[model samples]
Each structure stands twice: as C-alpha cells, then as structure tokens.
Target: MKEAENRACEVMLHAGLLPQLATMETIAAAAGPVLEPFVQYLLRHISTPRGVDGVSPFELNAALANALIEGEEALTGLVSLAVSIVPLAPAAATTNSSSLTAATSGGVCSVSSLTRVRLTLHPAYPLNLIATDSFLNLHTMLWTLSLQLQWVAQSLIAARVCLWKESQSQKRSGTDNNTTFSTTTAPSTRAVQQEMLHLVHAVRQHMLTHVENTSVRMRRGIATCGSLREMQKQCGEYEEELRHGCLLHDTSSSQLGSRKWHNHNDGPAASASGSPELHSSLLEVLESSLRHCILLGHARQAKILINKAKQAQLEAEDAEQEALALDSLEFAKQKFSQITCAVAATEREFEGHRVAFMERVSVYGSEAGAHSDAARALLAAVDIQGRWQPQKGT
Candidate 1:
C-alpha cells in the first residue's frame, strides 16, 4: 500500500497535481477524482498492521507467505495466523517475577511479557522449528518481494517517461492540445524517495542476515539428516525444494530421504549472498533500486522537455496573433519585412542559449547538486548491476 501510494504520488507530481492532506487516500487518488466525505468517512476508522511504523505492508504479507511454504498447509496453498504467545526467557523471569505474578493473577501488564519475543505461528511450522527451519525460511522471501516491487516501480516510471515523450511529440507537431507543466522538482520529492529507499535497505539488511543464517541452518540440517554421502550440490537443490515445497533429494546420481530440507549455499550466485539459496538476493535488490532510479531520471527528462517546449509554443502563438492584425497590404508588407529581418535571430541567439544553459548546469551542481549526484550514483550502480548478471546464470 505504501509503495503503491508513493508511485501514485509521483504520477500526480508528473501531472502537475499536488497531493492534498498527503494521506493515502489523497496521494492514491491519481486514478481519478476521489469522492469526498463519503470516502473519508469509510477510511476514517481503518487501520493496517504495522501501518503506523512506516513498514512496507509488503513485509508482513511476504513474511506470512514464506511461513506458509514450510509444511502440510502449503499443499493446499493456504495458511493463516495461529494463536500468538509471548514466552518469557529465563533471564527475564526473575527480574519480572512480581509483574509476572501480578499479570498471571490480574491478567494484565506483565513486565516480562514486554521483554520477551512475540511468537507468531502459522500452521506450516511449529514452535519447535523456530530455531531451525522456520526462522531460516521466514525472511528469505523478503529479497524476492523487494525485487518484484522494484521491477514494478521501474515499469511504472518507464511508462511515465513514454507517455510524457509521446505527449510532447504530439504537442510539438500541433497534433494535440497543450497543457502547462512545471520543471521545478517538489521539495518533498527527495524526502519521499529517501524514505522509500530507507525501507528498502532495511529489508535488504534482513535479507542478507536471513540468507547467511539459512545457509548455515541448511548445512547443519544436511550434516545431521544424512541427505547424501557427499556434500556437493546440496545447497542449490535444497533451495529449489524449499521454493517448491518438495522433498530434498540427492541430485547427484541418487535420491535420499535422510533430510526433509536442504540448502543451496554452494549454488553459483556468490559468497556475498551466502548461497544459491539467496539467489543473489542482495545483488538483485541493489539492481532493482538502481534500475528504478534510472527510469525516474528518464521520466524527469521527459518532464523537463515538456515544460521547456511551452516557451516555443507561446512564442509561436504570440507571433501568429501579431500577424493576424495585419488588415492592409501595406501593414502586411511591413510585418513581412520585420519577419525577414528576425529570421536569423534564432541562429544568433543559439550560442547565447548554449552559454546560459551551461551556466545553469553549473548552478545546478551547487543548488540541487546532491540530488544530481545521487541520481548519477544510482545510474552508475545500475550499470554495474546490469553488467554482472549476463556473465552468470541467475
């Protein structure tokens, strides 16, 4: 919901519309005119999990979906949250004894409860597997979720660029009605972008941690379960099994049911991503972010062109209006003479315009220099991300 709202906000920005109230309902109303008080009344009492924490709603959804794949419930492709509990660790038990006693007796406010982990279980995995399979599998899908979201972002931004360019072309050719556009970037635009990027990187850090942890867990599981006599090629196959909710097998000349799951720590991605288990999750995230930024830059360029061309159209219209006042042949001949004289004015001003543009670029470096640098950095990163993938198989 947050991601979708942000994209809608950007589209509204592109269309010279500002989000009023800056609520989800305000920003996401780019699709059409929003019905007023009725819509407000309906959404007034609505709330979503972690909605106030600025956490991407995708995180919870993805976490839940990943949790589903670990057991029998996955066969039905259905799962729901089970009973939740707060288990006090031994260390906290003594410190919170009085509060624990009060809570056990009074059924309220336990100091120990606040300090302990809130255990949320799904039917797919039991509490026993929390330290083993469930923990490892829980956060792995975050990487996939981020990449897919970023891919969608890139597509939307690219679409904006195409639409803007096409509109500009039609306007310039006098084939469409012209609308005024602003070249100025919004003050809050960078804030929104940075906020989104921060959430993304937060997700990426979790992805990295889970990938490494899961690879270790997979290795231990493999060693204990006796999946095969040999250790080679287990990680890749195991990750595949995890993905498909299938039995772990020895892909190397035989099959063994010794282990229920396997790890692809040895798969071809990189040590950076821990295993093929990660599918180069970190790299994919970085690439997706970079791609999104590049597409945004393309859209911005198209927007700039749209705004700057308005000057030429205005000038042509003013010239045509002046020419329309020529009621006499004498007046017309004099106007024609003036037009002939001004024919070379554009050629003469070309160098001046180039110099002025260069000056503006220099000023841009000092003014919005941070934004420009960030954009260039993103583009450079995109280049790197694009360079590596083709050399190896995903």
Candidate 2:
C-alpha cells in the first residue's frame, strides 16, 4: 500500500500536478472548517482503490471524469485571474513577469514568458492527448487570445497617432483665417510635426521589441516541438506578417512631394496668375500635412484637414484677386487726375493769348481814326478782315 502511494505521488509530480494540489491543500488548511467537507472528499477519493468491493467499474470511471472536469475548470479560472492581475502589477517584476504585464496592458509579450508557459504546460500533454477534442479547443482559444492581444497593441498605437493629429488640426483651425501662410503657421506646425515624428519612432521601437521577442519564441518552439510542424509554420507566418506590418517605412516625404506636384499643376491659369500664387503654396503645405496624417493612419482626421485646407485655399485665392483689382482701380484714378490737370493748364494759356490779341486790335483802330476817311475806311476793312480770318494754327 505504501509503495502504491509513493508511485502515485511520483506520477503526480512528473505530471506537474503536485504543486497545484499542494496549493489547494494550503488553501483548505487556511479555510479550516469551512472547506473541511471538500478536503475530506478529495482525501477519500485519493486513498480509495479503483477496484474496491461494492464500487462498480462504471461508477469509478464517472467519478474520475468528474474530477478531471473540475480540475480543468479550476485551472482555467486561475489562468484568467492571473492574466487580469498582470496589467496592474508593479513594473519592477522579473523580466518574464514584466513582459507578461505589458502583454496584458496592450504591449508586446516577451519570448521568454511565452517559452516558460509553453514548457510548464508540457506535463498536461498525456491528459490532453487522452481528450483530443478538448485539447484542440483549448489550443484554438489560446491562439485566438494571442492574436487578439497583438492586434490590441497595434490599435492602441494607431489610436494615439490619430488623437495627436486631431488635436494639432484643432489648434490650426483656431488660428485667424488670414494666417494660412507658413510665416504665420510654420513654428507651431513644425512643433506638431516633430511630436508626431517622435511618436512614430516610439511605435517603431515597440514593434521591433515585439518582433524580436516573437522571433526568439518561434526559434525555441521549432527546436522543441518537432512534431508540431503545422503550428510552427503558422507561427512563422504570423511572425513574418507582424514584422512587415509593424515596420515604419516612412513614405510621407515622397507622398507629399507627389501630392504637391499634382496640386501645383491642378490649375494652370491659377498657378500662372501671380496674385494667387500664395494660395498655391499654402495648398502645398496643407496637402503635405494631410499626407503625413494619412501615413500615420489617421484617416478621419486627415479627411477633416483636407476639407478645411481646400476651403482656405479658395478663400485665399479670392482675397488675392480682390486685392489685385483694388490696386488696378487706384492706378486708374491717379491717371485720370493727371489728365484733368493738364487740360485745365492748356485752357488757361489759350485765354491769356486771346486777351492780348483783342488789346492789339483796339490800339490799331484808335491810330487809324486819327489819319483820314480813306485811312479810317481802310482800317475798318482790315478790322473786318482780321475778324473773318482763321487763327494762324487753324
């Protein structure tokens, strides 16, 4: 009997069940009388032989099945609780512990933690094999959980970029409508751009850390789980996908250049018109900002910014045209004033010459009257002729 008990303990230890059973014993002891019935039941089952007198084989099998179900439930609950607590744990924990915490908090899980968990569960292989359907279901659940966690981490980073872009856009909109020029907006815009660049860089760091950890885990899994060919392949594919997805290949600069070129050529007449050139340059800056937003995965905010920029460009063009028209009108008024002054000066000079000609004719008439009738008649004829004749220039 003693030999049989020793053998059972050895099997339980090998299966990694001894620690869990020991933990339960400790809890039961702490609870004292409250868990007495449960403790007694477990002890009785452990001590009882499979072929005891009146116990039917079928009944014995049923009890063992019940115990297995209960044990599975307990393990599942414990794992869930641990996962829930990890995010709230202090950051100074061991590397595996800290990584596990980060994973629960929507950050990458460490390769070491993943490997440890995988190896620790190896003792349950015999039980899992005995219940193939259940094992498959559990595997699927674990796979789904890991994928979901990874997605959550990615989404969290994307969300931060979106929020930052939106806030910067709001600040821009709050400025005076006439200040769309870079001279007015450049300093603030540059500050926001720098912030965004830093954020993207941080995201890249996180992604690299996650990818490296996943690669390490994959190598270890491949080395140890030789029979799990399909699983290893799937893991490899997932890791590759993550590496590609998380890589921050910045195409914003190129995209901005292309977009600016397109916008500059969008309207030849407008671009050629010097008055509206300011608006075109402003549009280029706005389009560049929009492209940056799009690259960072802030589609909704980018859309809003695009619409605002378009409206601002149109308004700027109108203002520039109005200014040009006002200048032309002022120039015309100045020319009209100069022409009027020159005409008044010519009229004054002609009036002065007419008065002098009248004075000379009166003097000649007085001198001719003193000479004779013939001379007077001659003088009167000359006066008539002078009055009838056209002026020298005419």
Candidate 3:
C-alpha cells in the first residue's frame, strides 16, 4: 500500500497534478502527513542559507533566483520515470471460475505499469473559462518565456547572418568586378533590413500566440481551484485601472501642452512660466509616464519568462534522473543474469552431487539466486574442491 501510494504520488508529480510548493511552510502543510520524514528533510534543506530582507529589492531577487533554481531541479526529478514506484496488485482468492479473469487482469495490470508517464501540454483556457484562470496565468508566463528565448535566438541568428553578408559584400566590392555590382548594395541593404523587420514581426506574432495559449492554461488552473471567477474579476478590475490611469495622464499632458502652446504666441516663450517652458515640462511628464508604463509591462513579462524557464528546467532535470534510474535497474538486471548463468554452470559440473549439493544448486537457480550462487561457489571452490577428486579416482 505504501509503495502504491508512492507510485501514485510520483505519477501525480510527473503529470503536474501536484502543485509546486513555493514555500517551505506550504510544502510541510501539503506533504507532511504523507511524507513526514521526507518533508522534514526538505524543510531542513530549505532553511534560509542567508537571511533576506523582504523590503530589499536585492534580497527579493536573490530569493526568487534561489527558489527558481531549486524548483527547476525538483521539476526535473519529477518528470523522469525514475520516480515511479510500480504498485503491485494484491493476490486474490483463486477459484476455477475466476482464474481466467484474474489472469487477464494481471496481464492488463502489467501493461499499464509499463506505460510511460506522458506530459500533457494543455491549451490556454477559453477567455470565458474563469475556472482555469490560474493555469492560464501560468501558461501565459511560460509562453512569454518561450517567446523571449525565441526572440533572443532569432536576433542572434539574424545578426550573425547580417554580419556575414556585410563581410562578404566588402570582400566582393574589393575585387575586380566591384564597381559593376556597387548598385546592388543599395538593394541588398534594403533586403537585409526587410528581413530583419520580418523576423521581429514574426517574433511578435509568436509571442501573441503564446500569450493566448498561456491565458487558457491559467484559466484551467484557476478553474481547478474553483477561483476562476474571482481571478477574472480581479484581472478585469486591474486592467481597467491601468487603462484609466494611462488615459487620464495622457489627456492631462495633451491639454496642458496645447494651452501652453497657444499662450506662447502672446508672451515671451523663453521665460520659465511661459508656454514654451511649460510645454517642455509637459512633454517630459508625458514621456516619463510612457516610459514608466513600458517598464511595468517589461517587468511583468520578464517575471513570467523567469517562471516558465524554471518549469522547463525542472522538467529537464526529472528526465535526467529518470534516465539514471532506468540505467541502474538495467545494470542490476544484467548482474543478476550473470550470477544466474554462473550458478547454472557450477550445478551442471556437479550433476551427480548428494542431497546437500543438489539443494545448493537448486537455491542458485531460485528467485533470489545471485547471493546463493556466490556463496555456494565460494564454499565449493574452497572446501569441497580437493575432496571431489577422490570420487574421480574411485
């Protein structure tokens, strides 16, 4: 039963059914009853390596960084099949009528246990499904992260290609036929610029798609928690507030600047209180606000990306650990097979042995034969080897 529960837990974690423990307290709260000693171990490991001040930006970033790193490792461990504990079915009372049914069920159970754990990449929730809001939010964050990575990769590729082309162009221009193709440079520059623009445009489209998908996933997560509606209300209110503030600031700046421009025609524009000066101030304020908005958007997006990368890293680590475990299991099986073969060989060599020897040979071929074979082989080689020669002389 314990083994079965552990297998179920592993399956849940790998399937992402188990929510990530974001805090040590949360981890304890969720898993303490089920895994007391393990939870305690986790708590000890999770204790603050260094104190962090919540109000300090540096400390907050550092804490988040550490959480993400550890979270990634944990996620990876979960994903790999190495974490699975295949639960054995209990033996049933056998009767002639049930025998065939039991046999079939046993086969089915074996097949099921052998099935690999698969990850289901869910789509973002529908815009209407408030039920999945949290999942949608998480999905959105991952999508944003993927987009950022893709954008960076594309930018690097584009830059390298552009540089290579420029170098080639310079080399060609320096050659004998240079003047003949000089006119091509203008068109080439235009083409290169267009390509770069296209790449940027494509990246933006990809990001938009990712956002939509993530939004769906977040909605699903929210729905699972029965908080989708609440999340939707909060998000709507937040968006409304952001839009209202932005519009109001924009309007105020435009109004103030226009008035100052009109007033400047009548007075000396250069004076501190004049329209020209006030206009400059107004423009600065507008620009500053816009910059602030942009920064906020960027920060939000960056946070999402970080979260997504952390998830991906976790999945990767799980895969690695699972592979290692499978390798270990295979290694053990091979060692067992080698021992079995050796035991069989030794038994064949002593086919005419007495009851004790026959028992030893039987043990070497039994389910737990590896150790028995080693023991028997050691004893026979050491104590019984010379004595057996007398039988041959007789």
Of the candidates numbered 1 and 2, which has the greater lDDT value?
2
Give the best candidate by lDDT: 2
Badly placed stretches (over 4 Å) of model 3 are 1-73, 77-173, 177-183, 186-202, 205-224, 227-394
Candidate number with greatest TM-score = 1
TM per candidate comes to 0.26, 0.21, 0.21
Say what the RMSD of model 3 is.
37.7
Q: Residue 163 in model 3: shift from native, Å?
A: 5.0
lDDT of each: 0.30, 0.32, 0.31
Q: Candidate 2 at residue 92, lDDT? A: 30
Poorly placed runs, candidate 2 (over 4 Å): 1-6, 15-132, 153-157, 172-394
List model 3 lDDT by residue over 1-394, tens digit each: 6566455434533444323222111221212232233323322222222111112333333443344345524432322111112222354223412565322112122111111111122222133233143433333222222322232333335434543564576576563222111345335533433433343344234333333433345334433342334445644543322212111111222233333221212323222112223223323222222222222223223334434444455555577765655555445444434433332332232232222222322233232322333323322432332342211100
TM-score, model 2 to reference: 0.21
lDDT of 2: 0.32
Instruction: Write candidate 1's Cα lDDT for 99-172 as tens digits.
Output: 63322121212111211112232322211222234322332232223333333343334434554665566557
The superposed Cα distance between candidate 2 and the true structure at residue 137, in angstroms, equals: 1.8
